[model samples]
Target: MVEFAALTYGLLASVILSAAQRNSKMARPHPPLLLYLGYLLCGLSAGAALGLGYIILTRFIGH
Candidate 1:
């Protein structure tokens, strides 16, 4: 369950992040490495948050 939640949320976050980046009208381009790192961090954070929430919910519900 944790793995499922993590992967799902991580993928979702990455997709959204990429889409936002593509649609943004910035004067200067960001470095590729920086963008990659941002995506990585965002995905990991979102995954971890969802995974933790799932764990807590399960515990509270006594599943």
Candidate 2:
């Protein structure tokens, strides 16, 4: 379950980041490597945070 949630959130984050980049007014000819790394880091962090939260919630609810 945790793996599933993390994978889902990570993919979601990537999709959203890509969409935002596409819609930005100041579109760059090519995105910087740092920017791509930042997106990956953001998605990983978001997924980790959510997974932790889910674990805590399940424990709290005695599931």
Which parts of model 2 have CA positions greater than 4 angstroms off? 1-31
lDDT scores for all predictions?
0.75, 0.75
What TM-score does structure 2 among the candidates reach? 0.47
Instruction: Report how far residue 7 has shifted in candidate 2, in Å.
Output: 22
Q: Per-residue lDDT for 1-63 in model 2, tens only?
A: 989987987777776668667757567554576468667778778987999899999999976
| TM-score of every model versus the real structure | 0.54, 0.47
Instruction: Give the Cα error of residue 12 in candidate 2, in Å.
Output: 22
Residue 16 of model 1: what lDDT? 61
Native-to-model Cα distance after best TM-score fit, residue 13 in candidate 1, in Å: 16
lDDT of 1 by residue, 1-63 (tens): 989987987777676667557757564576686578677777778987999899999999885
- The candidate 1 region of ten consecutive residues with least summed lDDT is 19-28
Error of 2 at 25 (Å): 21
Instruction: After superposing candidate 1 on the true structure, give the runs of residues whose Cα lies further than 4 Å from its correct spot.
Output: 1-26
Look at candidate 1 and give me any clashing residue pairs: none
Best by lDDT: 1
